[model samples]
Target chain A: MLKINDLHVKLEEEDKQILKGLTLEVPAGEVHAIMGPNGSGKSTLSYVLSGRDGYEVTGGDATLDGASLLEMEPEDRAAAGLFLAFQYPVEIPGVGNMTFLRTAVNAQRKARGEAELSSGDFLKIVRAKAAELQISPEMLKRPVNVGFSGGEKKRNEILQMAMLEPRMCILDETDSGLDVDAMRLVSDGVNALRSPDRSFLVITHYQRLLNHIQPDVVHIMSNGRIIKSGGPELALQVEENGYGDLLAEAG
Target chain B: MSEIAVKTKAQQTPQVTGAPKAVTALDDRLAAMSLPQGGFSAPARAEALSRLRVMGLPGPRDEYWRYTDPRLFNVPGPQPLPFDAKAPESPLFAQRDTLTLVFVDGAFDASSSDELALEGIEITTLAHADAAGDHWAAGLYGALEAAGQQPVKRPFAALNSAAAADGVLIRVTGTPSKPVHVLHRRAADAADAVWHHVIRLEEGAELTFLESGMVGARSNAVIEVDLAQGAKLHHITAKRAIDPKVGLSHLFARVAEGAVLKSFSLAVNGTHMRHEAVIDMAGDDAVAHVAAAVLGDGATGRFHHDDTVFITHGAERGESRQVFKKVLKNGATGVFQGKILVKQGAQKTDGYQISQALLLDEASQFLAKPELEIYADDVKCSHGSTTGAIDEHALFYLRSRGVPMDRAIVFLVLSFLADALEEVEDEGLRAEINERLEEWLTSHA
Candidate 1:
């Protein structure tokens, strides 16, 4: 469902390069996890794919269903069924969470030539989905992530992920701030959205999150490129021994 | 207050100098035309005219006119700008039951106004009452405006007091059944409308005054309020001129001992607009709040808005707050000059002032001047002003959620004005104002 052809990116304001010749692919119906240490261009990969500003795609190609994702605007990429669960959700002081969610859901639908949902329809859908994630009505009414806890913010991100229902989802360090219970709840929310037509590319630094979501394939990334790919046992192997041993063995 | 305080306040103010260029400009511009007529208001008009001549119209050289150019109003006559009469939205303050008083091109529209009397409130129009020899509002016709000009010159307000043809004079003896709505509708394209409203609330009485509608192509307005001891008054204005119009307005209020005064204004659009407010806490423990929410989009037409406020704590334990917020984009401009003064012996006085602007683009700008003067040893006063653009990260967050750039901007802009809107005490009125803001943002965005 998602393809990257030796992606090369650098900081737009400086000569420093962040991602160098990184390539990865995630087919439909499969969950892929990219485990990498810090400063390995993991978050940059997600931001680059999502078309965020301040990044120069020096030499690379990222596509969704054979169409170049690099050419689309951020919102257009969203309409084309790409979703990024931000590592740090933004706090929009005066905008209500529900207002943002509804605007997003309807905007995407309209951009895709689908009829917009009525307020009643949207409210009903959001309420049911929010209840499943243990989110209260008051939380939905508050300003977007203004005073949310770490767990609450992550859960809010997952709520957004569930609502957008994008064809390709990129989880950029979604497990960084979650506690054990929050991690379980967030993984459960992601697990419930699993389907044949949907794909998720989970990015994490540790294998703890992998124990919950259980990825179909695991790739170890180092210095902006994936150095190894293996099955679920590789995650357990890294968990038992840190990335230090693995990096040395791979070298 | 019980008459004595009013006399004392009158005795405290110093004299005003003469410099009324606006008066001379008005006279010159209306060489072939007749300015608004006055009868019982003659003495007050004469006093205001002399004071305005000394104050003179604001000029580029004036210290008080540093941020906003008074040249547009100083000209003999501003060019006539057409107003859109077919606006799809309903008039502001129409959602509630109000004692509606309508005016057309500065003249009182008797046919369109409600009855002259409501329970506990006596309403008199300038044409009928000012034409005669005696009236209750005569004592207050230009008294407060005269007091407001001493520290800083307000030439237009004096010009308004000197020449305003028609307006409403309301005296409240008790709590009114419904609020009063002053509705100004435009008739002529070039009507240089000027109006003055004098309100006196009796001791222990209460009233809510709502002002809305388009005054005229070029207009100057003044509303003077006197709140008696223990009385309460709420004043709100929604400037509904969405087109490129030029106007200036002033609100001068005297808050008495134990009395409360709150006022808020929402300015949506105008080519050039200025709003000035002067509040006097004459008695002990008086509380006053003044706030404004303004939006200017220079994409379709030029836009500039200015808010100037002065609050004086003359007595002990007075509390005052000033909150002003503006959202400008596409080369629009906003300006704010606010001051709080705590007099000697006004111990434990509390004053707060905050002015902020959200600029959607680099071309837009906001200018602010916040001041504080204190002679009291024990007082709490704070003032702040900030100017910033839309958060790029926040914008991306919304857009990444599928909202377009324009829509996302509107969202952030509305959020930015939320602080100013909190000044409105009534929930229903606040919601209606929000609706008006939302519609304006959608079209402008």
Candidate 2:
């Protein structure tokens, strides 16, 4: 389970507050979708929780499985089973996607005091997962996201998530640049990884993606705080009427 | 009596004006040392010595050496310390089937060297070749070096030409089945070693030349290569020396019509090291590529590395490229001076030059001088120079995936140099070089 209470965040370089007194919690075996408009601190929350640099947590606490996530390094946070599917996956030239994946998997394993996967075993699992996601062998061989299309990048992210199998997954705008088909494919990849031991925090703007990967709970975030929490029908309500009604209701 | 008076008068008149004390000392040392007998042409030696006297050892005031100080290399006296000759754990080119030629303290060790015979190639020591008789190598000993002296003056190369104790002469009549490996080891810790190698590839011939190991405590080396029409040469060098060594190596190559020349060098840690190369594409449709990957760690702010390269496209449709990459950390210093020149009549020429440095820490410094001189109106020439720290975003991305900080840094550094390493044509050699680089990264980390 992941929990956030009175979370306050600000940019380290400038005196600008992003997340102000936000509170949210996603228990085990549940999918939660946070719908927000522009500048709602949606991305900031994901970055801060993932232990990214340049973000100062001024107040409040966030934890994963009752352990604090703020004091750990980014890698340590990752080993603690927190995953962030970036909105714009980085393009790392000269590093093959397969090499990156294997290194990541082995590193996590080592950090968790588990045995590393052999190359042959890693290759087999990766190939099967890739085939399911429509990732070509060429894409897996090329530099990570160097020349991949937007859909391919999203699918690659999903592949990484599948490989890592983190307990708490945060998808930041995974549906932004994806088309309808890509959205379904990515949603299916995500749905396949769903289990009682894993939970997903799907951060998105529209309810279209929610239609594919149905969330058990829907939260409307505005002004750096979740103004309302409801069931899946809330997404339908917001999809029919925009945030204008939500803002009025929250006020 | 009259000749002695004239010489004294000339010395008093300061024929070498404004030369540093180190330069004068170097001249004195050269004058005192006994010159090798025979194989070398007398006139070439005299001319090179005269050039060295005029240019002097490059000082900090010299434009080309503004970033690097040549005083350390110009010190007099032989290296006082003896090098430990128990070969390194992983000697370069150890896994290859090569014609290995070992040199101990600048002297060729026949006992450790392979037989001086190979298919389609001829090899002989400079002393033996010169002692035997005048041959093809005599014509090329200092020919390309003297030609490279124009436009920019290399006093160290001139000194090497004038005072080299011993070297090798290799001639390739056809494609050689195996590569020629030159492994240098320093037996005398403070030995001041000088050597000049001559290589000539005949028309339609092909050869690969490999050089590795530490030259010596204080070493000056010059390698001259000539590729005839339709010939090809692949030259690779790895300078994997331990600390407290100063070395200066120069490579001068000329490519004839339809010939191809590819040279790559990897330099790791050293107190002070500089590798200078001058390549000329002389005939039409000739191709030349010169690349280097350098790594320097300041060991308390003493390590320094410089790569100076000048490539010329002289004939029409000629192509030339210069790629240099350096990774410096912990106050280490890296310097790169690279230029690509296209002649006026050389139409359809293509020239590319890129020099980049990744400074791991704020104390590390990188100085780059990238130049492109295009006289041909229709030619394409481009040059770029960049000095930066590691990409933080990329680092974060990697670290976020559970890779440790140190491993992430190593990965990024290797990725930065991967493009330069790709210039190596042989996959096996490339892997060897990669392993060397990885070793360096792990040790440094």
Point to the candidate with the largest DockQ.
2
Q: Which ten residues in a row have the lowest lDDT in candidate 2 chain B?
A: B1-10
State the lDDT of candidate 1 residue by residue for B170-236, as single tens digits.
9999999999998889878778888889999999999999988876788888999999999999899
Name the runs in model 2 displaced over 4 angstroms: B1-23, B40-43, B78-82
lDDT, candidate 2, B272-328, per-residue tens: 888899999899999998999988888754888989998888899998988888999
* Cα error, candidate 2, residue B109 (Å): 1.7
Docking class of 1: medium
Candidate with top TM-score is 2
| Residue B139 displacement in candidate 2 (angstroms) | 1.5
Q: Estimate each model's TM-score.
A: 0.91, 0.94
Candidate 1 local lDDT, residue B241: 75
